[model samples]
Each structure stands twice: as structure tokens, then as C-alpha cells.
Target: MTDLVLRPMTPQDLGDVLALQAKGYPAALHDSAEAFLSRMALAPTLNLVAHDGGGLRGYLVSHPWAAGSPPPVDSVLPTAAPQDCWYVHDLSVAEAARGLGLARRLLIAGRDAAQALGLTRSELIAVEGAAPFWRRQGWSLPAIIAPELAAKAAGYGSSAVFMACEDIAAL
Candidate 1:
């Protein structure tokens, strides 16, 4: 972690961000550049990038969003709106950087940013069998989900599970 610098993500990082995303996620899960930029505009501090000697190695895109209302993948939010909790839209690390604990660092940074905004809860849609990984990070699935919400999760892809961290303090 000492060798990598964590900083607020800027438009300049999109190229590397997209490349890392492609390597880590299925095409169905990929967010368009406009979608990424829109979220960044709403919460610049929450969106972050990890830079090392090799260049940008990882990134996290999060924003202030209403809980239980995870936006569909690639949905571009054009303006500020009332928000209840922090939403982690995406987190990806380059294949070469996977073993270095970079993802954890980015998560911590994003969580800290959200906390700064007086937000205590966080939610994310875990796609591609990522539930176990998020669970290990202290997020958990609701015991039961509403039908409409379950259908919303389905839109993310077959294995997507809606998860939340009820207390960011615990993270």
C-alpha cells in the first residue's frame, strides 16, 4: 500500500479505469464513461483512483444515493438529488494489482469519504458471484427482499445480490 497513492478520481483517469473495469467485469456489468462521469460530478470526493509507478491500477465509483434504490447499470444521473446513504457503484482493480490489497484500500478511502458526508450506511449490488467477497468486507444481504427490489437486482445480471453495510463505522 505504501507504494500506491490514493487520490480523487478525475476525468483524466477514465482510460485506465475503463481498461481495469473490462478486465474485472463482464460486459453486461460494464458502466459507460458517461455514467461514470455523471456519478463523479455528484460526488467527486467519493470517486477515487489508485496510482502507482505503473499508472492507475484501480478505481472506486461511489455516490450519495437513496438506500434500496440502486440505479441500473450505466444509468447516467444528471443532477444532484436527495440521498439517504452512500452507494458503491463499482470497484475494480487491475489483474496485475489484485494480490496487493489495493481494493481494500480504495474501499476504505471511499468509506471515509462517505462518512465525511454524514452518511453511516452503504449499499452495493454485488454482481458476478461477488457476494462472498463483499460479505467478507462486512456487507450482508437482507434476510428478505421485496419483489420489486429483487427484480431490480435481476436487471444487473443473473447472480447479482443487493448488499449493504448497515454501519460504515464497523468497516
Candidate 2:
């Protein structure tokens, strides 16, 4: 395996990141290159790219969310203490990079970023197929989810679990 470097994603890397997302996830979650570039410009630090010697290998995008609020579908929620919580929006590792802990590394990097911002917790909506993985990583379902988020997640069926990690180290 090649050495991996984690860096803030740039506009130039958007296409590669979108391609990787398409390869890793279904169309529903794959954003267009323009959309991703826009996101990178809006929240550069949270848009992280993992690169090996060849090119982009993986990427993760996390945004802070307000406690007791619905997950924002089009924008990050306004918060008095934005650092208190983080929402892991998307995490994707190239097929070639799977099973090598690259996803874990990207998630850990997001956790560190959240900690640096003074966040005490991190949250994500895990699809049914991802629940086991999140559980293994020390995340648990929260007691309540915002109605809007719940509605948005209806398509995921009843098995989708909203998981959170209170400690970055635990992840």
C-alpha cells in the first residue's frame, strides 16, 4: 500500500472525488462535481481528501449540527456553539482503498477536526448496511431524531440507525 496523506480538499480535486463517490455509493448520495466544488468552497476545512502517490484515494465531508435540531437538507444548521456537534455528511474510500483502514483514517481525521473546534460529540445517519460498521466503531443510536431528518430517511426503511460517538478517541 502507498503512503496516504490527508489534506483539505481543493476545487481541483472535485471531479476525482465525485467519481470516487459514484463508485462507492448509489446515485442518490452522489453529488455532481459542481455541487461538491461549491461545498468545498463553502466549507473547505471540512471537505477532506486522502491521497496516495498516484491521486485522490478517498474523501470525507462533515458539518457541524445543532443539538435538538433537524438535520439540514440544503445547508448546515445555525448553532450558537457550532463546535459542540458534527454531522458526518459523506465518507467514501475508493474501491482500491477499501479494507485498508482508509475510511477509518478519514473519519478519525474528521473527529480530530471536530475536537479542535471543541465539539463534544459527532453524529451520522447510518444506512442499514452501515449500522454494523458504525457499531463496531463505537457509535450508538441516539434517542430522538428530528422529524425532518426522519422523513428524509424514510426511504432507508426502518433499519436505518442514527448513531453518535461521544468521544473522538472512542471512534
Candidate 3:
């Protein structure tokens, strides 16, 4: 973990980001280069990468989005990002780097960027049984979810959980 650096995600980093995705995420969770580029265009500052001088260790891809309506997985976002809340679209850490706290560090950095933009909340659809991990990070499931929203989340995976943190600045 020594020499690990957290920096704004750049276009040049997409190839490594995609490689990290293939290793760290389920095949179904993979998003295309077009999708990644769209988010980077929408909120470049909110997207981040962690590199340990060797290679990419982790990444956090987020953007301003409407709360309760997560964009579909692997799809490109709208030209203009909705400024409602911070939407954490993806967070992945290299298997070898998992125990070094890279994921949490990337998350905190993304949250700080969102807060600076005046976003008070954050939302994410946790796939692959990641809800518990997110819960530990201060995210919670809403008491009620719209049927349509639930269906959309199902597109992510049967186990997808739409979670949110109401007070972004607090964490």
C-alpha cells in the first residue's frame, strides 16, 4: 500500500480501469468503454483511481444523478448529468489490494468531491451481495422503493440492492 496515490480518473486510465473491472467484478457487472467515458464526461472530478506505482489498485466511478432512479448497468448516461445526488455507479478494488483500504479511500474521496458540489446525498445499486458492505459504509435501503425502480435494479442482478446515504457530508 506504500506509495498508493488517489487521483482524478483520466481518459488514459480507462484501459487499466477496464482491466481492473474484469478481474474484480462479475462479468455481468462489466460496463463498456462508452459507458465509462460518458460518466467521466459528466463528472470527471467525482471519478477517481488509486494507483500504487505498479498499476491501478481500485477505482470509483460516480456522477450527479436523480435519487431513486439508478441508470441501467452497462449503459451510457445522459449527456447532462442530473444534479440531484451523487450516484456511485461503480467501485472495485483489485483482489490483491483489497485489504489495504483502497476501496474506502476511493469512496471517501468521491464523497468529498460530491459534497463540494453541494450534493447532500448519495445512491448506489449494490450488486453481487455488496449491500452489507455498503451498509457498513453508512448506506441504507429506503423503507419503500417504487416497483419500476426495483425492476430496473433487477437488471443489475437478482441480488441488487438499491441503497443510499441521506447525509453525504456526515460521512
Candidate 4:
């Protein structure tokens, strides 16, 4: 196995990150480079990337957010919201990097970053058939959710669903 390093994602990593995004997700699911950069700026400490000498492996985009109140897809918030749930906006591990536990490590990083940020929970809009994967990672589908939050999740796509990691680190 090749040695891989995890580090805070930087602007220099954006192009590769976007390319990895393309490989892991479809066009309709793509988030713009501007939005990705905005998310990194909003919560630098909560975001991370995995790489080796070969290049990008995966990236995780996370931030502090209100529990059960995820932001809309692909749009950057004009201002930061008060810290609450540590929201994982996206996690994508390149196909070649699967089975190496990079995605798990990225999520673990998000959970740890959430704890460090003083947030106890985490939320994400799981889309494109990723729900089962997240479920195995200890994320749960909320039994109930507000109409607005559910609607925001719907914007992700037909298969998108709202999931939360209660007491994030516990799992």
C-alpha cells in the first residue's frame, strides 16, 4: 500500500479536488469550485484532504451548523451560522482509493473536528446512493424532520436523504 497523508485542504488542492469530485460524482451532483473554496474559507479547520505522492485521494468538506438544519446544496452561505452540529457537506473518495478506508478516515476527521469545534452532532444530506455507506458508518436517518429541512434535502436529488450522526464521536 502507498503511504498517504491527511492534511487541511488548501487552495492549491482545489483543482485536483474538483477533478476527484468529477470522478466520484455525476454532473448534476457537482458543486462549483467557487462554492468549494467558500466552504474551505468558512471552516478551514473542519475540512481535510487525503493524498499521497501520486496525487489526490479524497476530500471531506465540513463546517459548524445547526443540528438538523443543513444548508442548501451547491450554494454557499453569505455568512457563517452559529456553531451547533458539525455539518459534513461532502465526502468523496476516488475509485482507485476505495477499500483503503480513506472515506472512513475523512469522516472520523469530521467527527473529531466537530468535537474540537464544540459541536456534539453531525449532519449531512446523503445523495447518489451513498446513504447505505453512511448508515454503516453510524449515521442515522432521522425519524422525523422539519418540512423545510426535508425540502432542502430533496433538492439534492431523488435519492437524497437527511442523516445525522448523533453524539458524533460516540459512533
Over the stretch 80-158, how does candidate 4's per-residue lDDT look in tens digits? 6767788889998988889988888888887787787788887899999889998999888989898998898998888
TM-score of each: 0.97, 0.81, 0.97, 0.94
lDDT of 3 by residue, 1-171 (tens): 889999999989999999989987788889999999999989988999999878989999999998888999898988675789999999999988988788889999999999888999999999999999999898999999999989988999899988889998777
lDDT of 3 at 145: 92
lDDT of each: 0.91, 0.71, 0.91, 0.85
Model 4 RMSD to the real structure? 1.3
The deviation in Å at residue 112 for candidate 1 is: 0.6
RMSD of each: 1.0, 3.1, 0.9, 1.3
- Better structure of 1 and 2 per lDDT: 1
Q: Model 2, range 47-160, lDDT digits (tens) per residue?
A: 799998888889998766664442533343333333457777678888888899988888888888777766768777776478888888778877777776666565444555
Runs in model 3 with CA error above 4 Å? none
- Candidate 2 TM-score to native: 0.81
Residue-level lDDT of model 1, residues 78-151, one tens digit each, is 56765789999999998788988888999999999999999999999999999999999989999888888899
